[model samples]
Target: MTNLLRSIRTLPLLAFLIAIPALAAPTIIELSSEASRPAINDLVRATVSAEATGTTLGELSKQVNSLIAEALKTAKAFPRVKTQSGNTSTYPIYSKGGKIESWRIRSELSLESGDTAALSELLGKLQSSLGVSNLVLQPSPETRKKAENEAMLDAIAAFKARAKVIADAFGKPYRIKQLSVNTSGNVVQPLFRATAKAMMADAAPMPMEAGESQISATVSGQIELE
Candidate 1:
């Protein structure tokens, strides 16, 4: 009975002994930091839309469709793309006594995975064929997440560098204790937008400038102080 008591007492001590090293280790303190880089290391993407407007919806649709087909045929360097077909409505040109006089119809073609340089050249030729509807630069969801993670790691690295500086200043060199991460993206619009023009016979060819675009990733990280 006495030995059983002793064993029970000793078992608790053993447990504590095993846990001592883990408890005694210096705890790392966490510090958070953020870093932003403008227009660096980017994944380039482009959004191009073709629009045609006419007195009648059917006419607009037919004209735009014809232009799009020609663009596909004349595409010398641009990637072969499949544009999503969309329809848009325009208010009456002149409403007389609440009666519809004329209506406009527009179709949009949004495509992905086209070569940059070739796309620009194609655009130069295309604006005349199909009037540019809209354009934007951004990363897809998957690419965005990837860049965000990369940005976070970069921020963490920056944080580590700052932490080292602090430690050196204090005459106490340190190590990374703990870390967390975050990231963000912005939709930046272009300064200039292309004008509207339909490919009419003998009209001037488009002067397209599908210039190189930029994709940015932001990384933020928190490191624990040791």
Candidate 2:
């Protein structure tokens, strides 16, 4: 009777050990699929700065600060545009003799808006007092998220289709052993550099062209053919 009981206990252990090798899938394959689409740019951004050089640091600081403050006040006239202070730096201007000749101070104001036309008009007005340093056009967060979700769905479908094709080619059934999905987009546009001196001189409503970005999603995984 003791031997019979020992045999019963060993039966379960043996079965578990036997199942381990079957769980280690031998025919595993890795595959990846990607989907991308053009997303329309809906946001416009501009960076404007005021710079002054004088013998006194305090005087340069006052001038640069005053110009940035005036630009912020003008930005308020356009309710749709958003304004924020960027960078402020004070540095010494060196003379040809390697002596500090004067002090220079510069401050930047960042502007963003969904209404491109209004923002463009504001930029022109601000350029009269401040120099236009940079301009950018890109999709807003909401728009980019929507595009990413759409691309993810397409990419996942493509991955599954490819897995099915591979399984069929091998004349075997398959199951996903591991899977991962990632998303990315061309969010960084090429830096637009404008001649600040010339822009300040003209101060016309800045011309802009809204471009598109390629938002993409990739699905990668390993599948086991049974």
Candidate 3:
């Protein structure tokens, strides 16, 4: 009987132990760090487009193709320039009465170069047949990569410094629970735009300016205090 009574007493203790909840997780603080640097725009890009309209799709296609081919050949003569064909489309032109009057075909050629002088001269030459659709000045791939690497280093250092500051102020040691790094590339708009007729009228080389681009890097994560 005494043993049975002892067993009954132990049952309540086991129940109490099971009812207790697990320990709470430690607190975490998030920190964000960023770094940015200016990079010179070293690359120039120009887009030229050719369009033709005719009663027949075949004629329009032939004309547009010839123009693009000539442009491509001219671009190839300049060794420093890189050339590629862009978007091509064929659509029907409707008259005021809602009837199809002609077929319109359009093609684009893209040119990129680090040599501003050569590219500008080539653009001037092609203006007779092709119109400038868009122009942009930006950092080259190599330059952007270099800037991103430098920014990443700066961001990581900043993150570590901030974590140390927080830990010291709180009188505790910190460990990095998670970390992520991200990089951003800059976009630059063209400074000038010219029509085909205007470009053809002027025999002088096209003038251009390469501005500056900003590269940025960010580091964010949670730091656990111990």
In order, the Cα lDDT scores of the candidates are 0.55, 0.87, 0.87
Model 3 alpha-carbon drift over 4 Å, by segment: 1-25, 191-199
| RMSD of candidates 1 onward, in order | 7.2, 4.6, 3.4
Q: Whole-model lDDT, candidate 1?
A: 0.55
**Candidate 2 worst ten-residue window by lDDT:** 187-196
- Expressed as tens digits, the lDDT of each residue in 120-161 for candidate 1 is 455556666465555555555565566566666667677777
Task: Give me the displacement of residue 182 in model 1, in angstroms.
Answer: 1.3
Q: After superposition, how far is residue 104 of candidate 3 from its true place, in Å?
A: 1.4
* Clashing residue pairs for model 1: 29-224, 29-225, 30-223, 30-224, 30-225, 31-223, 124-208, 151-219, 152-219
* Candidate 1: 10-residue stretch with minimal lDDT: 37-46
TM-score of 2: 0.85
Q: Which stretches of candidate 2 lie over 4 Å from their true place?
A: 1-25, 188-191, 200-202
Query: Candidate 2 on 150-214: residue-level lDDT in tens?
Result: 99999999999999999999998999999999999875444566534655566578777778988
**Residue-level lDDT tens digits of model 3 in 24-128:** 356589999999888888899999899887898888888889989988888888999999889998888899999998887889889999998899899888988
Model 1 regions lying over 4 Å from their true place: 1-30, 36-56, 80-82, 86-91, 94-96, 137-150, 161-179, 186-188, 198-226
* Candidate achieving the largest TM-score: 2
- Residue 92's lDDT within candidate 1 is 59
